[model samples]
Target chain A: GESVGLHLPTLSVQEGDNSIINCAYSNSASDYFIWYKQESGKGPQFIIDIRSNMDKRQGQRVTVLLNKTVKHLSLQIAATQPGDSAVYFCAETFPGNQFYFGTGTSLTVIP
Target chain B: EAGVAQSPRYKIIEKRQSVAFWCNPISGHATLYWYQQILGQGPKLLIQFQNNGVVDDSQLPKDRFSAERLKGVDSTLKIQPAKLEDSAVYLCASSLFGRSYNEQFFGPGTRLTVL
Candidate 1:
């Protein structure tokens, strides 16, 4: 079955440094992708999203790069902070609004 | 605005037991979704409802899992004769409309432990 996957299960970065999380999806028909942040004991919170038509989208201090040709997605956080410590997941949406999520990547920001 | 709401933050039940979880989506949202997230894994969509009508339930375990979004507002997910693999966090999410580009707001989730 087609699925979404992450490149790394965990990552560690010094506070104030930048961080990048990578994800790969198998479904080429997917039209939309999103990045979510989940703190311990909480549900995922939307961070940013991009459509297949676009190659990049940016939010406050965060950027989502989509490589439709390779079916790859990446999230970049500038000047990572302690609050950025959480698990990040990438999701792809099919035509009917059904979303498929990847095995999350845990990001640890050290002070 | 309030985010998605769910009940009974945690539950522990033995295998073969029955359990139910509830969710209240953001007001006026017409699309509701139920997802199962196992520890160390991402959330997997189990079902989706569009204004009280099921739009997709392909991944739902129909033999033991069922859901309904009565009145297109609050929804419930029930699992009968639960199995150990059913132990996971059930998350409820909603979007303004059932569109692939719309953002989905998620709830805190209900954690279930099947003993």
Candidate 2:
């Protein structure tokens, strides 16, 4: 059985502060992970992705860290803005399989 | 490049009423997907298609849900006698192919309200 879940259902951070959202997966066989951000009334948009081989990956304003030993993944948003407030989801996928998405964490940026 | 397109940005109907949603993938995309997302939750895959062929539909509620991609380009998802629990956003996504490593671009989802 494979399960992905977030540590927190909601997170609030001050504008311009850093935000870290955590996720856990039960499938050790999972080799790839992706982060998606969905705004109100819109479908999810891709944020960043990390392969099992890499422990950390960085994008423009986001960073994904993978801890294979702990079966945990985390996404860090730098200088969070009002527009960055959205529901974030972490999805895991093994080779030759569809991705399994976590419940998701709502991020609220307080100005 | 144009992204995936879905129709009926919003739909409201009473329980037991049948409703259908449509999706048109990006031109040349060989793979398409339909997902159901309840409020405050992530999208749950209902079906996947690889050029008009069913790839994965293990989570789809076959008893009440049906979907088709007749031409390998456009798709339709229908819910028969919808339930109150069926209220959610139906999302469509597409990729170049059913590659496990490629990103699937998503479209504006259709909000379904089954009262």
Best prediction by TM-score: 1
Assess the local accuracy of residue B4 in candidate 1 as a C-alpha lDDT between 0 and 100.
96
Q: Write the per-residue lDDT of candidate 2 for residues B7-103, one digit (tens) a residue.
A: 9999999999999999999999999999999987788999999999999999999999999999898999999989999999999999997977789
Give DockQ: model 1.
0.87
lDDT score at residue B111, model 2, on the 0-100 scale: 97
Interface RMSD of 2: 0.9
Q: What residue runs in model 1 are displaced by over 4 Å at the alpha carbon?
A: none
Off by over 4 Å in 2: none
A29 Cα displacement, candidate 1 (Å): 1.3
For residues A32-107, could you state the per-residue lDDT of candidate 1 as single tens digits?
9999999999999999999999999999999999998899999999999999999999999878658889999999
Which pairs clash in the backbone of model 1?
A: none
lDDT of each: 0.96, 0.94
Give the CA lDDT, 0 to 100, for residue A84 in model 1: 99
| Candidate 1 lDDT for residue B56 | 89
TM-score quality measure for candidate 2: 0.97
